[model samples]
Target chain A: MAKSNKPIVWSLFAGGGMIAAFVLPAMIFITGLAVPMGLLLENALAYDRMLALVGNPIGKLVLFGVIFLSLWHAAHRLRMTLHDLGIRSGRVAMLACYGVAGLASIAAAVVLLSI
Target chain B: MGEVMDRRPYVREMPKSWWLGQRRYTFYMVRELTCLFIGAYALVILVGLFRLSQGPVAYGAFVDALQGPFAIAFHLLALVFALFHTVTWFGLTPKAMPLRLGEKTVPGTAIIVAHYAVWFVVSATLLLVARA
Candidate 1:
């Protein structure tokens, strides 16, 4: 068997998938359902509160981890999906898919750091 | 008769709606779509960050806008899609990276339980942090 650099990206993708699965739905539920439906206090997700959370060093890291890894996970999944769907151009797909994820990661880092 | 035969394997043309024909294929399609939903949610978070960068007024407006029906619906949809994605992706763990425990391999159920356990711990920690 030949070793390839894919393990690096694949590890990230796997980790991202785990975190996204673990954390995202509950997040979406709270913001989407609980807050909007009045299940929680009006200011549960208030701007000040959210800003404070994002402004927290730990919170900022968590936010970055969630967004950045999820992007890579989605990107790699989509690339494999394109191949699965019978798109024959492997090199092109890999380049485009990974390229987008990389750019998005940089953007996420910038946004988090600026905050 | 002796003849030289041309050898070309037939490639089946995949149609746009190929996934619609079967239950499993449809499931696969739905799983594939999680990437789109997750990717979109990440973008939404980025937008939230941008609004935050603009200061309280813009951030407040963004938070207020999130209460709208459309935003709620989109979030709900993304949540379901993310759930599906998580389950299916998690189910692949045993196969993706089989773990060995002493002389025996760890069971799939154990792997899943471990993932969920960590998930709960992390979520709980974050919630507590945010609350405090």
Candidate 2:
């Protein structure tokens, strides 16, 4: 029986929007290097083994927090996306979007626990 | 002509609420899905970075897998969505975060324009550096 509210939705939207803003510049830095590095120079940064950095406390914290919150934001937006797409049948859409997001959050938690 | 049954000329206009009907709903869904794709692109990057920080061997495996066709296609699609999302998201930012100076409220359009100006400058600098 939760009430639907625009402000709540927008707040989550804005948070996701902020994450989007942060990611683009970062990707430009990463892929901009990874592409050339992987293709031309054969840099190790192109590989996932560099995930050794995640063992660091700061890295672990950031990764877990980002994964958890971003997924939370994603679930809400995905539900809204379905609704906007003319899936006026609320129950089905909610189950799908929320189900996927819930699984993602659980995986994130496991990753954090292992770290 | 009046005595004839001409049903062709009696068409009615669509209802006003049709703006909120199926077509508009589909458009709205597309817009949000575009953003979701953008979000997915970012997550992949974050996950890659995390894996990289783990170990060189693991990172190498990721790079190898990424070279596959599916990975490349996803990247290209994500790039398109990210660009679209950035444009639309910034267009909404001023509405999300309004700035007031004295009596005047800053407009969303101006804010979006300013963001583009900055994005252009930064991208230009990066290109110049890369070229050098």
Q: Which candidate leads the pack in TM-score?
A: 1
Report how far off residue B41 is in candidate 1 (Å): 0.9
List the pairs of residues colliding in candidate 1: none
CAPRI class of candidate 2: acceptable
Provide a comma-separated list of chain B TM-scores, one per candidate: 0.85, 0.63
Every model's DockQ: 0.55, 0.32
Off by over 4 Å in 1: A1-3, A88-96, B1-18, B124-132
List the lowest-lDDT window of 10 residues for candidate 1 chain B: B123-132
The lDDT for every candidate, in the order shown, is 0.82, 0.60
Interface RMSD of each: 2.2, 5.2
Complex DockQ, candidate 2 = 0.32
**Ten residues in a row with the worst lDDT in model 2 chain A?**
A41-50
